[model samples]
Target chain A: MPSRISMRFVIDSSVMQAAGRAHPVDKRPKRCRGFLDVVYGCNHRVVVTDEIETEWRQHSSRVAVMWQRRMRTHRKIWRPPPDAIEPLTDAIAGVESNRREQKLMQEDLFLLEAALAADKIVTSLDKEVHGLFRNAAKEIPKLRRVIWVDLDEPDEDGAKWVSGGVSLDPERMLGSSHE
Target chain B: MASRSGRGNHDSKQQDAGVTRITVAGFKSIREEQSIDVAPLTILAGANSSGKSSMMQPLLLLKQTLEASYDPAPLLLDGPNVRFTKAGQFLSRSQKGEPGGEFRIAVQLGTNDRVEICLGKTPKAGFGVRRLTSTMFGNTYELTPEMDHDAVRGQLPLAAKLADGSFPEEVREQCVWRVRQDRCFLGVEATHGDGDHWATFSYLPAEALSHELRNLIHLPALRGNRGRDYPVTAVGESFLGGFDAYVASVIAQWQTEEAGGDLTCMNGDLELLGLTWKAVTRRVSDAHMEIQVARLPRSTVGGEDDLVNVADVGIGVSQVLPVLVALQVARPGQLVYIEQPEIHLHPRAQVALAKVFSRAAKRGVRVVVETHSSLLLLAVQALVAEGKLSPDLVKLHWFTRSETDGTTRIDTADLDEAGAFGEWPEDFGDVEWTAENAYLNAAEKALRRGMKDAK
Candidate 1:
């Protein structure tokens, strides 16, 4: 048997905009596609919620179109449960009064709901998502975790990797401590 | 004639930009992003499960996927090269997350030339060149790290201009590649871009990159020497997992097409194996090919050696034969990844194998060795100390596991001018140390008891 463990991940829209550029002509500093490439190459499951897709459409539609050309429904994206939304908002509110955080809007909550139902990770560069993870970590022991990554930073800088919430070192996510 | 000249011109343009660094992340035991410097000879030294193969596997995966022509070229997990089924089987647990997570790999070809590739899950999973930066006009990053990009834009073009002046007018004026939004949808740009932002240079497609990866001979550690008559196959994939089919194909190729010197080298290796003066020759049947070893009498003065079946020889000879043949035919700028080239060999032959690596490196081939034999390492050191292998041309990486996180930690072993090491890992083959100590202790106790009885 192989020594590696199967793992899960979720990517956000802000990072998707930084997918690879059209070299020579397209001059931009987006290395975010590297993160996705590594995950997929390693054969880990990736989940993308509809709300995240909607957010991606608002900004990184080009990358979304690129995915359309090559996307396959094996372990790439998760089918969010229809009822994941209400429970996620209730879980978040029960954990803390995050009803007014503007940076992470309703779609992000949907992303969180999608995460909880499937036990997927929420990878976001937004501080609001990190705040929600911190709150959920403190108040809701059974709540699923999020992984915060800063793709905008240079490779040599601090915490450019997927850092775990709920105090997971090397940055992993877990909903139940039992597992 | 024009096309051939164009190819030569293009190769000469990028010849200075050799691949320098490789980075692997979220793959197997190598969960953290790790970078390894490529030298003419790189030695990966580690105990079991220390992430040496994991680092090399990323390149092999890409090579195999490209060989199979996997769609989108980089995202497929299951293929002919490896039997990987799902993402979970290989992802580093320390680095992976729920979904939408990814593992990335990048190769820095030179100072300013690099290609980065990423792979994530399926059903929205796609893999290809994530980022590619190159100075097709032969630009290199000779600037200080703190130098501004404005300085790069200023200084790099001047260097490229000065160097590119000697290039043919066709290469100097023509646009060879273009970039669309897909980044890797690159081909010959039929239409000129609207602005000066156009790179107007060469493009190395995913297949080209994969070709670079395929220019390697990866010998897994679980190799064996014994074989019966095996079927022959095509040229490149002939040396698949085991030497059964691969060795026959290799021998057949040797008989029909190889230069005479290849067999001479193989004979020299056989001599080192103490199968003194025995030469390897093949017997072809209607159904199969037989590799036979001939025994030579001590009088090289004037006697012909008759051939016998390779199976008649010890397992060690059959094992080391292909290894020697492979090294003998290695071309310049090729990569050879050997798991344990010293397997099933006597210490002397194993040491001879070290000379093989030194010789291969001297031939301009890059050799990547992952071995458990201290003799091989000592032989390499001896070669270095004797000034046969240059110190700068050699590299060593010591893979050790973290006590707390249980992940791998690879440290570059520093080599100085005299082929001495700054630090060597403790546990490659230290079991011999323990066994020797046990023997000494028991011998001393037995001697003492005998003396007391005599008194």
Candidate 2:
């Protein structure tokens, strides 16, 4: 049974682009597709920032586009204003020092900002950035609250978390909710 | 013209002159109150029998009532714009077929003023106004029948301000009239027009509202008949009937004017729509005139003398003529409600009509269109994306009927800067999507089968 508590999640463009591919051919895309289905069926909202929306429009397939359009109709798509984005981006830049990690952070930091703006939940396929952000969470208190999920990995299960109402589990979360 | 005092001076800002929003409740297929914001270019789209037309019917009812020669009923059930025989024909009914008690209609002006009128069936089996209320410039005024129903009492929050000569002079004069005269049926005053002038001012808001309704122009789905020769009728002070009926006479009137400016613009629009013909009116007789269209010369050497009667051309041209003419002659602050502007034209021509509607909205004519053409709507979206029309000036309302109760509900959406709707219903353009997908899937399947057979 699906949990009654609805969650808001920021779905990275990587997952959306793969979910849009032909479903019968690949195991990775099929998992991504199944995660989105579970997310929608459980009444969880999909959050997008301006940059995230632009990326989805450019790279996502027709399947993802149709899903997003339906989400808009159901009022289940949240577009949080950029009130906290610019400052948060600046903060992320200041916390990271390595040149290579800095470049990756700059590219994926928007997902964190959007997640912070909505619920502190993000479902992404980018495992490299997920590892980097988990390492950086030690320096930033706000980043500690982010709960990252990677459906591409064999061990990670997205459908259970979504159907269970995305409860605060320390194993899936970077750190504790309290600073 | 007596004392015309207390006439309210609304804000004359170009952006704030037309109707801004409308609300309807307890009307046919609309059991609950539904309100929609009116933009410069408003589109109403939905499935058939979803109450898309019912939402705008109240405005047409008021227009026809104000245009009636003699005041017979509070609302003219059967008229030129909309036709119905009895009050029960339009009143709301329960799921079990029980009729509702009363119906309410409200119009909100761009100036932030709102007027709401309620009507019910009277003892004589005729529709009568039960209550009229208006909120103007932060002041509220109401009128209703007295205890014995013999006299109508006025309720004004700023009665002292009205008596102190602070209100506009024209509104004061407009409000002061005999209640029983029925000249201003919207006022519903029963105070026998004695020396008590303040009692009459309560109806001032209704008078102003009626004036606004009278100024509205409507073009029904079915326009005037196509005829080779049109009789020239005298232009009335206001719209006496359907605006479509006055299209030819107005064209003739423009021909007699100094510049014939609107006629030239109308011809240009006709050409833009790919009609490839210019309309000209000839005075065949004193009271009769004929409209002829000449095809554009294919070459410079070709003469312009080859003219044919409008009736002889394609029916789409004559049907769209009235819509073009109405847009050309309309003033900036006026509202022109048209149903199905793309009736018989080709898809390309329907797309061209979007440009015409966008230009008219740019010129400050509030245009409300109810249509089923996805081509026309897509063209409007393109115009917004290209920055030719502001997304802020456009609003789209989708009406959906509840499958369970058969009542209507409206879901409104605004276009983003990219011309994409913020919230679009699933089935809005799903038929086209479904057809395209089906065709693609069929083609792919056939190709796979052919390759296997060759192997």
- Chain A TM-score vs. truth, each candidate: 0.64, 0.88
**TM-score of each candidate structure, all chains considered together:** 0.55, 0.69
How high is the TM-score of chain B in model 1?
A: 0.73
By DockQ thresholds, what CAPRI class is model 2?
Answer: incorrect
**Span of ten consecutive residues with least summed lDDT in model 2 chain A:** A20-29
Query: Which regions of candidate 1 fall more than 4 Å away from where they truly are?
Result: A1-179, B1-19, B69-81, B95-100, B110-112, B126-208, B224-226, B233-246, B256-259, B275-287, B295-305, B427-435, B445-455
Task: Point to the candidate with the largest TM-score.
Answer: 2
Query: How accurate locally, in lDDT, is each candidate?
Result: 0.55, 0.73
Top DockQ hit = 2
Q: Write the per-residue lDDT of candidate 2 for residues B194-271, one digit (tens) a residue.
A: 355444334356666676677677888888665777777766435566786677787887777677676777788888
Question: Where is the poorest 10-residue window by lDDT in model 1 chain A?
Answer: A156-165
| DockQ of candidate 2 relative to the true structure | 0.08
Candidate 1's TM-score: 0.55
